[model samples]
Target: MAGTGTRLTLLLFSALGFWTLWGFPGKNNLLHFLGELSEPGASIPGPTYYPMKQKFTGIAPLDKQLTTLVGFFYTAVDGNRIDISLSFLNLGSQVLAAWILITTESYRAGNKGSFIITSTTLFGLSVVIVGYACVAPIWFALHLWTSKVVSNPRDWNIILEQPIKLAIAPVATLIGFGIPSAVMTLPAPSVISFDTKLNWSALQQGWPIWIYLAQKSLESIATWFQPMVSMRTEKQKRAEMVKYMRRAYLFALGTSAGAHLLYSGLGLAAYFLPGALSTKLQVQLQPENFFIPPNPFSDEKATTLPNGALWFLQWDLVIGVLATMIWGIAVRLSENGKQDDLGAWIKALVEYGVIAAAVGPSGAAVVAVWRRDERALKAKEE
Candidate 1:
């Protein structure tokens, strides 16, 4: 059954990732867009091609793509009101998902089994280049097969959430991911010059690089800052570690839930008080726009650069959410993984549907992880 689930997830994500990379964007669109930017001094085709709005700077294809990414990212914040909300939502969820899925907690004594991939750093460079839709599933599938991280007690026993990591996760998520995003969204000239915003947006594209650097740097800086303290015993240290893990979980819950409410409330406000809000703001805040995804089955291309930008990005968000939900439900840690499996899933699906609708996907994910952790802790205690 585990092998079957693993194979199915692999096939599903591979197909979806291919479609998302090529199907939605179309071959001509990709060629034409890249062709236009292939040269440093290319002519602007039109507004439709305006990543063409920000002229391509680099001569090489990879360099050109990286340069174009700066403007492409900026458009979500500065382009359409609707895309801003969706883009920000995805951005927030992406960071949270990285933390949840990867848990790149720093290496320390007593934390031997921790998953740390330094090549991408903690932030996921592949996620940067290939989109989260593609990278997350591959990562999740690797996790499903390589780590005995199911909901069973014996399986989870080896994967203890380290105390140092639990405390650091929140700090990493906030500073490493959160600060970069906030800077990218700041208003132009008044807050920062237009050029500065673009440059900052350029820097934002390399999140996988910077977040990991920041995390590791923080590890060193934190060592000095952490008050001179020591655990009394092995048992006391383990209990403290559990406490830190729970706090990390709470931090995730609060951040995700707060965002869900803030946006949902604004969306509702836009619905009721349409006259008070600008047309674009209204479009941005509409909850309906938040979850709509490109037709993954279709090869039709987006009409405009901004639409293409949205299309370029949205699948990762949508597919990432789907994959997480599957991981949460399928990787069972219930009291009876074999005996109560079916009932556990049915009940969890219902509960997740309710919570997800109310609080948003990230919020529901936090709840699921928290519950899973609690169950594992209880079983370990017993």
Candidate 2:
């Protein structure tokens, strides 16, 4: 928190938090809905909220908000503007890459400390209570400036990590994040019961905790069956570490690129082959629709359901990516490399553009981290 990087994070993302909040359609009569979460069904059902048109299910308010917002987005897209729905697919991909990257870093040796900073359970729980947009900047800043692994990259002792921990990271990610993401998106009344979907969506909000538990549980099992974990030779350990880290980078790269390409295709179809197959809305989908942030300074409020969704999501992705890029650049700058000249930076930026064009923002971050790991391992070998 004392470093210049930490201060910069606060200055930039704190404003973003406010901008996202500007989408809070005041007078939505949400106070009662929030209050009953602790003792839901304790009293008679009250007024129904917009979009859902049903009483709150007494779940965590964040889960309820996520389910309602996503449901509204799909319904709106189904009715019209299928192109806008495409944005969610792309953004969802980017968010996934960011999540995977952060989850991986949570296990770094230097990252271990206070439960909030290093502890996986506490970190995941915090993100559950506070949205990624709120938690990520602080987390990124802590790593860039304060964490021993990032700050003292060359110190071998700072590299403390269990092989089983690395191996289980991706598995936990799949079970904890991937499955829940898919389950919550199941179509209601047609594919699954709306109430069931709501229940699952609420559960998904605590994915950070789920991922932690999954990783620990898997690690414990691996320790029992593979008791020779600590007996591996140095060469064997190094090779295995490289393999797992490479797998992580590939997973991050593939998911982000896949999502970006999927949605990008959908957006293009809106213009190129309007009414292509069963798609709705033949209106043009502009780049601004995906890249631009809503006017946060306007006198008008985002009082409608669609506008509120757009306002919140647009800022969430835009700000989230920007914060991630800053942290990536900070790490890249700190890595051991030929960074002394202007030519190197221009080449690096060019390479980043090429990767980003194909895979999206999260891919760029993953590549930066991949390169950093390569440099660190190379240094160790030397």
Candidate 3:
């Protein structure tokens, strides 16, 4: 049964990853009739060539409005804005699904810390899925390593909260380390040639790259420490792990939610003051500025997408991290003498629905495993 579940998960990962990469933006296989790319920078002469530019009704009102709005600004930007937005959404969903699926598998295997390692590793690898499919190998490596080590219940509680920390660490590193390093190291002008005549500013334009590099470097350092920390005896682990997990969940949640608001706030401000704010906004949406990591094996960075896609990125990070944090807090709070049977079930079910809906099959599987674990807990108590 476990083997079957693992195989099914592999299939899910392959299918979703392919659909996400192929169906979104540049390689839009699904809507091939709308626009066809004969090759990079080459298009077939046809009636509906690059229909992203054409006026058309979307399936729903919001969709139609969004489509129209995106098309209005698509040509002004360096890259295909609409395609980039949609691609990032697809990419985010792909990562969410993979995270939920792998975490569920780790939970099912009775290795609590394994999910943390697997999810973080997958998060890092998702950035490079464009160049190479390293998901399977990373999964196996983390899985094998984590499986050998059994965590105490107290330690498991601490490990569960670290994923939220892991998620935020990169963003923190970017702001704290990447930006300062880049500012010091980048050339005086900090501008690079985008096109024959166009200049792209590094600090102003390469925010995404800075964030990616910061996160990748920080994640490697953090992940290396996880095993060492996990392996420590109770005396060695007690003080630090307790201090860390107590605040990790809340701190991570606050940062994620705060970042979302900040991004949206800037967008709204930019809309009203385009002349005043347009240059600042332009820095974020600089064309062909997409980040390609230095190496395939150790790092991952999301596609260099348009500014409009920041909303999707915000939603994915905020919601995903928020959900995990809330779950951790609820469980921690319930660590009293008696279990709140109804409350636990209700929370678990709600999470299942949300994850399944937002993330898809993998989420549903995660919730299902949680439900099983809950029932077993109750049975043991009875």
lDDT tens readout by residue for model 3, 213-301 = 66567667776877564355654443443344334323333333343334334444545555665564554433223221112122233
Question: Which 10-residue window in model 3 sums to the lowest lDDT?
Answer: 195-204
Could you give the candidate ranking by lDDT, starting with the highest? 2, 1, 3
Best by TM-score: 1
- Can you write out model 1's per-residue Cα lDDT over 1-382, one digit (the tens) per residue? 2345544775597578767765666642643464444456643223323323243345555567665566556557664445554556654664474454356222223224545322336437666776667766665565555444442334234344335555666677677667777787786656876666666676677666666676667766666776432433556656766687678767766666666566566767777888887877877666565446556566666555555666666666667666765555554433346413656666877888788766666567667666655666677678
Error of 3 at 111 (Å): 5.3
Weakest 10 consecutive residues of candidate 1 by summed lDDT: 44-53
Please give the distance, in angstroms, between residue 24's alpha carbon in candidate 2 and its true position after superposition.
6.4
**What lDDT tens digits, residue by residue, belong to model 2 across residues 1-382?**
2247444764468466544643342323222333333343332122222233233454466445654433444432332344445555666668767776776676666676635456656655654455446666777776665666566665352343665577777788888877876786675556876566555665666677788788889988888999998678767777777888788778888878898787666666655676673532444354455446556655544443444455555666667665765566556655643333456556766777677777877888888877877788887888
- So what's the TM-score on candidate 1? 0.80
- The clash number for model 1 is 4
Worst 10 residues of 2 by lDDT: 42-51
Mark the regions of model 3 whose C-alpha exceeds 4 Å error after superposition.
1-17, 24-123, 130-233, 263-382
State which candidate, 2 or 3, has the greater TM-score: 2
Task: List where candidate 2 sits over 4 angstroms from the true fold.
Answer: 1-11, 22-85, 114-116, 155-160, 268-279, 337-350
> Each model's C-alpha lDDT?
0.58, 0.61, 0.36
Give the distance in Å from residue 35's predicted Cα in candidate 1 to where it truly belongs: 5.7
